[model samples]
Target: MVENMHERPGAPSAGDGLVRLYGPRFQSDPAAIYREIRREHGPVAPVLLEGDVPAWLVLGYREVHHVTSNPQIFGRDSRRWNAWKDIPADWALRPYAEYQPCSVFTEGEEHRRRGGALSDALAAVDQFELRNQVERIADQLIDTFAESGRADLMAQYALRLPVLAIARLFGLSEADAPSLAADIAASADEGEEAVRAHQRVVARMRRLVEEKQARPGADYPSRLLAHPAGLPPEEIPSDLFLTMGAAQLTTADWMGNTLRLMLTDDRFALNLSGGRRSVGQALNEVLWEETPTQNFVGRWVIQDTRLGGRHIRKGEVVVLGLAAANADSQVRPASYAHASGNQAYMSFSHGLHGCPQPAREIAEAIVQTAIEVLVDRLPDIVLAVPAHELEWRPSVWMRGLIALPAEFSPMYADRPAG
Candidate 1:
């Protein structure tokens, strides 16, 4: 466990009242914590990252929208962050907070050019073909555990399906998909393993780019290389790495969280056994209630500004409270039922830096299909353990289950091939 901030010498004084964004309380039930923070500190509250680094957490819906919309004042460049000097070389969040040459950190026309190339590449993907690919992957995954009567869905299904589809989209072979998926999961974690895992992902992407350049195909990497943006060869790997990491983890959590909601919530219990009527509703509700991405290490202030009744200094970091924003009373409907069909939540952020339309479509297709296929294959599936007994991954950045143990009637009968 990380030592309490109060016990560390020279830490922000107790009177400062800056909340640590990590630790047990935040991981266990972040929604409750967000409400408490908003009650005491208003919308924009002072907070500490790992090592007690200072930053602001934007809790109000309007404040989050404003910050994401006004890119000129709040930039994407992490190099400008005032807290970089205080960050350790081996910071667990370095992969997200550090400046890299990818499209994620670029600004102005440069960003438009690189982002346009990405949008175009993703746009070229045939949605019909992608959906078919996801369905086939989903069926094959179910075949492995369909007869076991018990399985960990997180490791066995939700975690593996999206990466396999993404790897295929990138033109990687069947043998490489498993290792790539493992590396992506490890890279999202803390400590030395994450760092090394991230390096491996990048190296693999670099090799993929080289191979595509020599022998072009209908894959994402090939489309990127052939795009008219004239992106440099060296930079394509970083962009591909970012795309894979973002899609794999976020989509996996979307599936895992949706399954948890369906199995555990009384609202969706009627549809748990091969009912598709509530699948769309459950998927949308998860985005508003239990989004895969809880918080983001976000925009750096370009200059001093006043937001959400708080004074933010230039170069200070402002974490986007995406989950908090969705729960903001000002915009959130009084009841979950009322919030249906209202897709304005900040799960995907907003404006230039938000998830692109094509990427969102691909993710929705993969997640929706994965869930539908699972329910269809194992109509009698039920949670092996009580919902409350299930543990969440202990990370501030991502919200997902550590495991989703489930049980169903064993089936030894032969199944039709997809």
Candidate 2:
């Protein structure tokens, strides 16, 4: 219904366009930049990534739905991208732009085939059992730092719990969790390093797939192996590879961001103090505000088309501004109540390409469980460093804390290990 179809009158030049994703300015405060972009270029704005690779960054709420839902026109399968045809083999984004055998990189019936496997695999998980496992991990994590009185929650808790849980779900041994976690974390980094890390992760997953094939176990990976999707032997590990990377990063970042909000924002504390809000409500707020994945990868243009009033040519890349779209004032409620009952945010995206693991639900469960366990055990927990001084990692597609240092009353962690 909102109809200002063409690019806004004062759109910036391509050379001096929106904020660069890999720069410090974006790392500092991207919301302010997103606002400036919306004012000048409407919902879809011209932006540059690490290599000055031009793309349209979609920032409007309705606009996001328009592109994501219409995968036929806005294809996610990068193998079809026309622009990459000319780029050198060593292009910085090649690692991502290149074709992978994962469902995330496919389109149409192929996507359905692969995604169905992923969805079925995820659906088979027992939510109650998953929560129980998460809680056990949370308790074990707290036990490590409970007596110290001070801990970096980012490292000691937020980042590790989800990874550990996911590793277990994949039926990996306790010893493999740390190494797999490291590979997953590194794969999310920028530049050639990310490419190298991705290769390492793929190799590790291939080994895992072979292991599961020879001696299957009662885990998600094994489920994928037995599924009716009839996924090729080569595709199985690639699917698992993508699933592991996506789950670990998003869940970890979500937990970290939510914990950061509770520790840094006095309003959240006051809400808890007055019992006006629950930790779950705080999570919805974070999803709407500081989205876990700040931005995401390319949705290649299949043909020239008009979107959000801009002229998008075939083969050009379009990135979804998940956090920015969530902040779109025209679509988002003016107050918290309007957003409360209807948990509609671009955090999980909307259509076929949306996250299949129920990341939002899993994150909420993990974060709420972790916070409740921490607060119940250490009622006096407080921030070790001032909130304003905290640092965020610079990422092309993610926004996360480097560390979340907190101080709490020391106590013995006598909880039995699972």
- What CA RMSD would you report for each candidate? 5.0, 3.2
- The sequence of per-residue lDDT tens digits that candidate 1 reaches over residues 9-108 is 2222234767887787888899999999999877788887765777788888988999998999999999988767777877777888888898899998
Global local distance difference test of model 2: 0.78
Error of 2 at 351 (Å): 0.6
Off by more than 4 A, model 1: 1-17, 270-274, 415-418
Distance from true position, residue 266, model 1, in Å?
A: 2.0
The collision pairs in model 2 are 5-309
| Model 2 TM-score (2 dp) | 0.92
lDDT of 2 by residue, 1-418 (tens): 2245444433323577456766788788888888988897787888877777667799999988899889988998886666665566655566666778788888899899889888888877777988898889888889888888999988888888888888888998778877777767766766667777788888888998999999998888899889898888788878888788878888888878877887777666623343234567667788887877878876988987777877777877888899898898876768765466656789888799898755545656666777777666676677899888998877767778889999977997458999
